[model samples]
Target: MSGDPLERIAAALERLAPGPAAAPDWDAASAFVWDAHPDALHPVPEVSRVPLGLLVGIDRQRDTLLANTRRFAEGLPANNALLWGARGMGKSSLVKAVHAELEATGLKLVELQREDIGTVGRLLALLRGAPHRFVLYCDDLSFSHDDAAYKSLKAVLDGGATGRPANVVFYATSNRRHLMPRDMIENERGSAINPAEAVEEKVSLSDRFGLWLGFHACDQDGYLAMIRGYCAAHGLDVDDAALRAEAIEWQATRGARSGRVAWQFFTDLAGRHGVRI
Candidate 1:
């Protein structure tokens, strides 16, 4: 209190500011969410996810991602993965399910938000020499006009000078295969003096991911299988014929047939029966 007013004000400001984040307790949890502001990894003890067996549709996608993840976990050479395709077809779910399925092998999943792409380099540096292998996940990843954050992400994935750590691999889920709208790439093509190179630079971001597993929309049988799987797992006790009829009616009302819709219908059915899933 006796100090000069300016000095005292500065001291107060410093105290009010956040301190450097604590080093992550990597062993504390199987999953983590990377917080870039304070620069810390937050543990996720209970991940919100469905069991891999319950995922129902997209068997091929499920297998491909699992294989690549397994290779990475075993310290074998593995490609960064891009899970792209129809919405709610389990792109993000597959990533989480795969991590959960393989967590016993010391594979850790770290979710980095799309907005935090610029800070990925810092996160990679932290994970570079760690004993454990990490799958850096970004769900719903995409880029818009003039957003340069993707450059840092590209550098980290492609491994600029140091190269990506053998212990770390990146996985992302996106509705767009290129993580950019077709129009966005076309716009670059329309404006650039050299259209091919301009477009190549933008679309090549996806190329960094060696595994481009696409999850397409499921068919009627696929959708029904999803609903039946959930019903059986949760003990809904509904007859097969009745279940199919209700599920079909539900999809008709909603005008869609995907895993998400199946789950939504199951939720309603459970609610009516007073069964908590």
Candidate 2:
């Protein structure tokens, strides 16, 4: 034990400060969830994601993201992608599905929560030198009016000094196209002396993403197709007429029709029919 007061104080400070995070075992799993408190990547042995073929609507988004992810995995040029638009349109699902399809290419998926946006630089530093390529995913990403975490996100997307590691590509899903609420942008425009620049400062964060894919609300036909696809995949036998009537009634009850709503309906139908999905 140190007898000197200065040495004792230094020891206490060192103990309080978190130690450098340990390097993760790259071969542990295909997907991981970043835990910011302890600064660790927890392996996800089984990622809950639907098959690429089963995603009925949004074929255009499916193809584009697949191609982009493929390029990144192959060590070719690729862009950080932002999947933004309507709720329950499978923005986050697509990210996972694409990564699953390309997992054989030595590509990995690391989920970064929206709350941990500030620790992205530290996360990046850990992944910078890893051998496997990573798709850094953040689901339902959005920023509030007073939040400054967006600046940290900019650093990841813009890659300030040490450019984003060659092995890492960022992919985020959000309901907001600009990653901020419309009211927040309008607030900035109303208050700032230079309205354009003020709005631009916040909106420009989205411009950092090279690929901006938008997912809109699925049409009735598209919604029905999603249900049919799920039924077929699980081999749940139901008459088309009955299925249509029941599914329509279900949608009516929910007051919305989306891939998610369709799945919810199918889940109930499957349970009734004793079919496991």
Candidate 3:
């Protein structure tokens, strides 16, 4: 018997439409990276993160984030958080570290890349009914001029119809406090028919995050503290005078002082001492 061509064509088209992703095996891994293509959560068996104590110079931020996360892990109310400020000041590091610190409480970390943000609604749907608590993290998140993705993000964060899942919290790190370039903000101000409205529309996205933690460029003392913390954590022993002198030289050559630089210097120091960190 000859089959109808249209029937076969319809079957092929149905196959082309993406199917619902498999329910994630939350117990398989402590961390995941959301994949939007086929709408799946890829397990991350090993998450690279520093010990919470090894993170120095941002003690105040550390305490605040830890408290918020702890409250959420315990099934209490907690607001979405935005970690904004200086580059390499440990904003992203803190998110991972805090997740690691709270892993014992069954908190899970899902790193959603900025590119996959458009799929946030789907991701939330996948996570909504799960027994686990999740931290949806995005690193170096920012919106450039002509980028419309932020609108979707703003909507999801604002908890439009579906609302954010009670078991899930969001934590994002951005170099820009407003998550937009200064030039972009200025351009909107210069060209918009309603200047104040235009500016507010772009800037208000950050308001969705109830908590804003600002990370600043570390001072010399803060940087030194980071270096020493790394040394102590890794069992690297060096004379204080020599270590400080070399650290100063490293900062001078790099023309910056931050936890990242201190860590880089520590790596070199460890290498020189024939120790692995």
Candidate 4:
């Protein structure tokens, strides 16, 4: 009262802040991020993901992802997903896209990084009590020789005291089918007394994923089709022959064909034609 009304209110609020707080409860979060530095769950609201419709040239994979995602959102049993294979072929994109599609049905996608794989149990605990369905997504997930976080992942997937949340599903992408290097597996194969036992280390990790959706490099026809799809969707004015030639040239310069390459081609064509898309 002596100084200002605002100052008195601010001082009272400051006194209420918690000090030396205990670990945050997983049950309180609708979303959680694995902060590996402190090994904690950080809540987030907005997740970055593209629309499912923008994804092109992978019809089969798209349908599969959509079907699985819908099933999970509907409170039905769904598999833990593993999106593996070629890089930049829309594996990670599809996960985000599907998450967005399912949002209309009240499901959410929570993304975590590859390095934070060790904290999956903590994440699982948070999701365990969530009323909302969650899709835990990890992009570019893999393990090296010294990183043994796969064991924690395995336990959370099916072996932990608090099993995977009934309302949660996991989606991870990796270039390797077996989340470890071939040399690492081979070296273990050579050193171990039992080769079968040694290889199981890698196999068991992959085996945890109930669904395996593979992405591969696009062929010429497939690549062109993707370009045409983008052009049509964006309502860009370009004849098939002219568009085909330009897209081919773009891919040739890059020396490889993937979904990422196709999008880049579309971007350049859009600019050349003065299309705002």
Candidate 5:
């Protein structure tokens, strides 16, 4: 039988680019990111993270997260955590720090972007057979009213028969507690035939996460402490009195205090003082 001309062209393209089956070995990865285009996992050997000690004014949250992460790494029972609250309060930083701290103990961190939640199942599937423990880190993970991706996440998180691979834990940071805005849930309640049930269905997704760590805006004292901590860690030797004065002024100008704001102030301080931070 004669081969079709289209078939010959398709064969040529296949020879050039091939299918996902010809892709690199995913199991070789100590870490992975989910690629949704072809529903596959991309191998990543090294993760980008900040040191654990530099995250400040969150000792309670740090201790809780450290303990939970340690337990998971030790092969004990642990909860999937949701770190939520104020913007730039080190919610995402804490996640990366914890991952870095635990990596020496054989833990691996895989960062999945906010837009990749729907491909979570494919990522989970890829990790199920890997030897190292996995922390699925998603930063800034809130959803809008029209976004239906959370349903897919609900399935991957708890409903899959594979059921969140025993070697994996989820650590997500968000500006909202339930990963949805109050208005979204309120609108569902106002418009649905059965208000309570409709709200419950939309709200219950967060209930799947067993641990909730809330991050609030830092007080001036706490914020100053963080600035000093970063300054000290990075060897920026500004005098204590001047450091405090500048940190306070920086916060005042920003009209709010947070880890992010503190870091920004420190960066500017280091630049002006001709020191590294």
Candidate 6:
């Protein structure tokens, strides 16, 4: 209805800009997924995660992360954690499992997808003054050469001027320790006038995390232990010798041995045994 050109332009811009994100019902669920487009938090009634005991071969990581999360939940000093290592080694699973284990401590789990990294500051703003503590988790996170989203992540990790909310902590899982491909880092070094500074700027994003837990590839024994643990947890009966022989063959065919592989193998074995997990 505005006749003036300036007023009309302003109205159009206002319509284009995204509205403020809605305040989430913190008590709605133990876990939530962040959606950037609509700027909302979708509650997850049932999060898919195995028990802490079922996770094998990464005891150090499990213990350390669990302690860190517990401390955060207790209102103690804690650091943002980065779980970086081999794929299918349970980086993201550990984050979820730790939160589940400590759910009674009044901690909340907020999952933010890698593509939603740019909107993290807005997400943090919504949680900044909330009463409950939050573990903002990003799974399978990494940055491409052209990606600038990592800068936004720094605001969450480093917490610019106002500083990160005491009630909120960040947890991210990535295969790369630096959250960048090796070739990308090398390219920065080769192209930039000051290679050190260039590389530092790119790699320093990972340094923001106070805790770095590395997950190595699982060995045959560890793999088998994971399978046995799953079987025991699910009450799936199997002979040790037969399980070992079949599991080894399964891994050999798949060409990798990790918690995920073990679980996949178990799923098939459970199905064959007519057992439900």
> Estimated TM-score per prediction?
0.91, 0.96, 0.94, 0.83, 0.87, 0.97
> Predicted candidate 1: what Cα RMSD to the true structure?
3.4
Q: How far is candidate 2 from the true structure (C-alpha RMSD, Å)?
A: 1.6
Question: Worst ten-residue run, lDDT, model 5?
Answer: 18-27
Q: Could you give candidate 5's per-residue lDDT for residues 1-277 as a string of tens digits?
A: 5899999999888887624423346456555676666666677775655578888888899999999999999999999999999998999889878877876787877778889888787677667777678888888998998998887787546766657789888988888888898998988899999999998966888888989999999888889888888888888878899888878888899899999998899889889988853
Candidate 6 per-residue lDDT, tens place, 59-126, comes to 99999999999999999999999999999999989999999999987799999999999998889899
lDDT of 3 by residue, 1-277 (tens): 4689999889889999888777788899999999999899999999988999988888889999999999999999998999999988999999999999899999999999999888888888888878899999999999888888887786457546877888989999999899998999898899999989988977888988999999999899999999998988889889999999999999999999988898899989999999986
Listed per candidate, the RMSD to the true structure in angstroms reads 3.4, 1.6, 2.0, 8.0, 3.7, 1.2
Candidate 4: segments with Cα more than 4 A from true spot? 1-34, 37-48
Q: Which sequence of candidate numbers ranks them by TM-score, best first?
A: 6, 2, 3, 1, 5, 4
The digit string of per-residue lDDT tens for model 4 on 1-277 reads: 3989999889888886433223455455444566656555576665555567777677888998889889988989888988999988999889877877766787766778887777777667666765678888888988888787888887556767667888888889999998888899999989999998988967788888888888889899988877787888889878888888888889999999988898889888889889986
Backbone collision tally, model 5: 0
lDDT of each: 0.88, 0.91, 0.90, 0.80, 0.82, 0.92
Superposed model 5: Cα runs more than 4 Å off: 1-32, 38-48
For residues 120-206, what per-residue lDDT tens digits would candidate 2 score against the true structure?
A: 998998898787899999999999989999988977786478778888899999998889889999988999999999888779999
Predicted candidate 1 versus true structure: per-residue lDDT over 50-76, tens digit per residue: 899999878888898899889889989
Supply the global lDDT for candidate 3: 0.90
State model 5's lDDT. 0.82
* Clashes per candidate, residues 3 or more apart or on different chains: 0, 0, 0, 0, 0, 0
Which prediction has the highest TM-score against the true structure?
6
Residue 63 lDDT (model 1): 92
Off by over 4 Å in 2: 1-9
